[model samples]
Target: MPLGADHLIHANVVCSDFERSLDFYTRLLGARVIGEVFEFDAGEDFMTILGVTGGARCRAALLTWSDDDTATYLDLLAFADGGGHAARTAKDTGLARLGLRVRDLAAALAWIEEHGVPVVGGPVTLTPMPGRQRHVVTIRDPDGTLLTLMEFPERR
Candidate 1:
């Protein structure tokens, strides 16, 4: 028998500044805020949950790219006492980046450039098969979290 894992709920990104990161996601990726930003103090429950001691607090909100209720969400969270830094490189391992599939890479790039967001990597073409092609680029958020935008050839 195999463990029944259905789907990914959300990936949490610990931001240095919650509002800035939220704004970046909304403005650049068109992520809509699902609800109000809330904060809570972490007691023994959070300590066990996050593997930390007492006195940890968090500010958080869920963001979605679409209006579907079952859609996966981006959980943007920040800690009151957290002073951690982001992963320096994708090779550093855990939660490297969030990859989003877009319909138009050119339009996305244009909007990103117009907003003064630097493109860290290519809009390079990837041709795995004769008819299959993918265009990709990498950009960072306000907290330097890598986001990969990929556009694939439309299917018939």
Candidate 2:
């Protein structure tokens, strides 16, 4: 029999400003720094793999959780020479938008509002996956990147 996967390994995100992204992940999201890599060694390799040019001067950072609770790791990347394209709007595109699971949807929305982030959608119920329930709220970050904060009280 095939073995069942325990957890997700990692997720990669390309950012325009490496420092700002790192700060957002570390400060706002509470992610800890696991490792960092300079450009000269793995920059060219990454650019080639990503099908991009002039990214040899970029920087990469690997971040992990504080505990081994079987959570997905995040790879924060910045391209010094060749910045990637900006994130598309949710109305016009179907792309990646970071999802954060919070305990209280209303409290989280309040905190996010106080922080000056604009809320796109309401604290509404979504039944996209049958038999699964998710209370979600959408917001836009400083870079206009859409993010969803979900509360899974039913799951708990």
Best by TM-score: 1
Lowest lDDT sum, 10 consecutive residues, model 2, at 35-44
State the TM-score for model 2.
Answer: 0.74
Steric overlap count per candidate: 0, 0
Shift in Å, residue 72, candidate 1: 0.8
lDDT (Cα, tens digit) per residue for candidate 2, span 24-56: 667665678775544454556666897865445
TM per prediction: 0.90, 0.74
Whole-model lDDT per candidate: 0.85, 0.71
Native-vs-model 2 lDDT?
0.71
Best by lDDT: 1
The whole-model C-alpha lDDT of candidate 1 against the native structure comes to: 0.85
What is the C-alpha lDDT profile of model 1 across 97-156, one tens digit per residue? 889988899999999999999999998998878978889999988888889999986642
